[model samples]
Target: MKESILLVEDDSSIAIVITAALEAEGLHVDRCDSIAGRDCLLASKPYGLMLTDVMLTDGDGIETLPPVRAAFPRMQVIILSAQNTLDTAVRASDTGAFEYFPKPFDLEELVRTVRQALGALDGSDLPDAAEDLGQGLPLVGRSAAMQAVYRMITRVLRNDLTVLILGESGTGKELVAEAIHQLGNRRDGPFVAVNTAAIPHELIESELFGHEKGAFTGAVARQIGKFEQAARGTLFLDEIGDMPLEAQTRLLRALQSGRIRRVGGTEEIALNCRIIAATNRDLVPMIAAGTFREDLYYRLAVVPIELPPLRERADDVEALSRHFLARAAAEGLPRRQLSAAGAALLARQPWRGNVRELRNFIFRLALLARDDVVDDATIEPLLASDNAAQRAGEPEAGIGNAAPADFATALDAFLIQARPEPGTLYDSALAAFERPLFLHALAQTGGNQLRAAQLLGINRNTLRKRLVDLGIAPEDALGGR
Candidate 1:
């Protein structure tokens, strides 16, 4: 006889489709709608495999896993849910679910997963004990993304493993490192942070491993490095991608041998500190390009934790905004609360700078808004001003015959020196130079597009077209003025 499969799904349409699919595969399929109904079914017969949804009519599908596991330890369980958050994936993994399928899943993939589960019916892959990540930690956000990060952090706290945190700039890579140090067994030990990118390339080795007096022409006095300072503690290397390859070799050696030789020093110092490295850049690409060392990358990335960009975690925006606003108020900025519309406005923003950008914007709102409650209207002008300032600072390829090279030529040279393949250079340069110029001209003329056109030496119709193309409303220019 074919093995039996139990499917617990609330949606009748989904159940019909899944049942048909499973039955077509020559397996006996049972269907139910809730955890209670599942318990009833489980009590009656043995199921070779179980597929369940997270939200059921009577109770959560996740709550049914324990009892199902307890009664049928070797039975394979697959969790299907509409909730596609990082937290949900982590929770499913913790609960020993064979597979997790987000809503709108591919039927072929589901069938494949089911077949694999049926072929490998065993409990050996599940954890002996599920780790308990304590509630209300320093990291905010109950978003699925944040929950996954929390789970990974808690897993590494008990061990002295080197952790590599990857994320875009300003996404709190440093904060994650700090949390690891604070929560880990090394809580009492000193937590030292060093920005590898900020330090001078020539002096980085001396800075990390210390130097004896008269080691070099500039080394007049004996100085202890970051490693010695962070003895029996945690050393956080921030922006580690920017470290020179020579320094990476030294770092890799130190990590391998658990010892470091100071500059011009004969004896090797024994090192006993946990290392946590963070970077916004993708090191794999750098490794391929020969800019970063592969061995060093492996050594640092033993336990990798990637932070989600702020835009990806939209559910947490309001909470993070409020947190920043409250902090600004406590620091003597005018007390303020975000209006519902303002909160929604924050949630909708792209937030290219991530959490740091959001925090700074909140600080600006608290400082600028006169009323206790900040609204969407109050935020618009400030955003315009901030955007205008950023645009104004961008390199402008102004038309000038005084120099031998034209604007584009100069830009090409600059781009070559910065990096060879500066993608979308022409359009970015044009937009950057045009925005502030047009906005400022319009603001000076009281939002008069015609007058702004005259001042900018462009046609009025052309100015109008540019404004429309740039998504700049006339009201923003007026408000900014």
Candidate 2:
């Protein structure tokens, strides 16, 4: 005799597909379209496992699970739903569902999950109901790409595992952190967020660890650091990849010991909060460059949640546009509705800056749209003009049409990522500026050191030494290394 499973889904088409998939896997299946019907089927015979949807014709699938749990404590349950919201995911987790699959889930994956649930009921670890907290985070998306992120958020809600959110700039990494903090066990505690990049390198330690009065030239009074302020709460570290190496050492020590001491204080304080870190930069290259600490990366990545960039999840663009439109109207901006054409147009954009850029554009459109509706025709001109204005605001590349280098832009970028000891800023900035200039001269001279030297208006020996100092290969040629 084959093992039997119960599937409770309202849609006949979905029920048929699921039943067929399971039956193809060599399982006997009983299906129902209502909660009452599900109960009727369950009472008729013991099921090897149950697959349920949150909504049913007769009653709520998840709400009615308590009775099922009481009647069949050992049977595992998997939730499938079309609601496709974070709230649904959490609710399913609260019922200790083996897994939550939002609609349009991969059938093969679902079949695999069913096999696993039936095969290891006792050994499997379910997300405990102890983490039933947090109003569903205000993340708006039904994209399949976002389902993984939603699942990750629900898992960490039951524990204090440190989370690291990674994504491109404006991809809502901070929002993911907020969701974990807001939905996790420590929801009631304060959620203190600090951008590690915004603080000066000299004062970053003092900001995070707090400093004693008279501890340094500017220390006049003792103050509480973010860690102490966020006790019994969550301390979010944004732009964590940019933290100074020295500060990373201190932070690692604090995380390891679960305690901290003020810069000059004698008393050590115990940590009572959770840690969540996020960064947009790719830490792998930084690790290779010796700019980021490998040990610290491992510590912060206990529950890493990588958010998909807006471009990767373009299917959500329409929903996100409307979501932002609703907010803009609620904030007193003119109300506007998105048309299918407008949404299609928006989705076609590269969205290079990710969600943040899209959100900004939507707000501007809501305020500027002459019609209550936005379509390709209406948004197209605005886009061109908006892009034009942005270009106008940008610093010119050079005076020539031959495309000379943009040193001003380059310098600004360098300063942003510049890490240099005081009084050495000149040397640091100089080297960065000279390397490209030297490389260009070398390329211009066709591998001849003397000619390259003359082209650079410097002595041959001096140019040779500078090339070695800057580590520029003398063999470099155009269009090749």
Candidate 3:
């Protein structure tokens, strides 16, 4: 007996192709152009599976799925959409779809998914629609690399699995964590983020697991740690690779036992939060070097998602450049539109700093560009200046890369936006320059103050004093390493 399948797609061409492929596999594929036609067919006939596109003639295919699922509880669903953003992916997952295939997906893979859908057509629980996922969708790009990431994210949206995101700095790891939290089952609870590497080795435990009054020199009262504060929610541990060995032991214990005790308290408070960890460092090498824990790595990386660096996805640069330009305008920067040549030129750069560097470049372009529509003429001068600065010693897009004219423009903008107190302008300006400078030095030395001092060609005592004066902790800057 051939199994029946319902495919509700508005595009006649795509429908023909899918129907031909499925019919060849000895399956009966019923095609429809709208949700109303789908309902009429489903009411008259039973189907082993249903494959639908996101957009139809009458209404959104995904939005109307809940009612269809209610009436035909046993039929499985697979969604196909041209909308490739993370929001659309999450929305598809919210409807409890058996699988989701973004446009330009592999036809073989789609056929395989259809076969799998029919083989296991049990009544799976339909997840409640996600509420208020927010307007801010940070993760962008529709490259095949990004599609892989989106699929991994959807797999974890309905569970509390510990997710470990791996990528170079500025590859939007935090944004990935934010998406999982906002789209996952625990969306109603708070999302608490703690950068473990930013806390001093001596204080990491107290910061994450709380501390009773007088537990340490600076413990003035019973403070809630990130673990407890994130109760029934999610805890995002950024830069997990930089956590000290001593703190890593304590973290492993908590994960193993599902409980935590304050630094000086007796009662073991049960942990009740989903943990999402991210680090740019390659942990396999770190594990062999006896820095990151292998056992703890296993626990954290139950489902590791490696984000593609910008160099690999240069195709997405134009889209990302325009996205950043729009955001810059919304944030009160001059409204600028990227030209075709301008986007092409951007796509050719190595983008050593990944998306973070590209975003910074776009914002600067929005600020300094001469014309409303920026072409290569507008972008070339800026790139030339930045390249000259890079050759002169600074990393790509560093503070020291600014020319005298560029420096003046930045200072003028700062003056306008900061509105510094008349008497404190010099002090404030000096502080602003020194903060990134010191942080850059500390980062190059891997948090070793002695080395950072040497790197900056300054006395260790001077470096220490300046770090304190500027409130720049070695841990804070060293996280990027």
Estimate every model's Cα lDDT from 0 to 1. Answer: 0.81, 0.84, 0.86
Order of the predicted models by TM-score, top scorer first: 2, 3, 1
Give the runs in model 3 whose Cα sits over 4 Å from its true position: 121-123, 126-134, 394-481
Clashing pairs in 1: 87-144
Q: Which of the two, 2 or 3, has more lDDT?
A: 3
- lDDT of candidate 1 over 69-145, digit per residue (tens): 87678788888887654445545655667777777677887988899988884833645233333333436675667
- Among these predictions, the greatest TM-score belongs to 2
Alpha-carbon lDDT of model 1 = 0.81
Q: What tens-digit string does per-residue lDDT give for candidate 3 at 386-428?
A: 8887778855455656765356556655665666776887887
Instruction: Extract clashing residue pairs from model 2.
Output: none
- Give the winner by lDDT: 3
Give the TM-score of each candidate: 0.62, 0.83, 0.79
- Cα error of candidate 1 at position 274, Å: 6.2
Clashing pairs in 3: none
Model 3, position 411, has a per-residue lDDT of 63
lDDT of 2 by residue, 369-481 (tens): 99998899999998899789877876433221122223333444565577667677679988987777777766665677788788668999998888788877745534222
Listed per candidate, the RMSD to the true structure in angstroms reads 10.7, 6.2, 12.8
Candidates 1 and 2 compared by lDDT, better number = 2
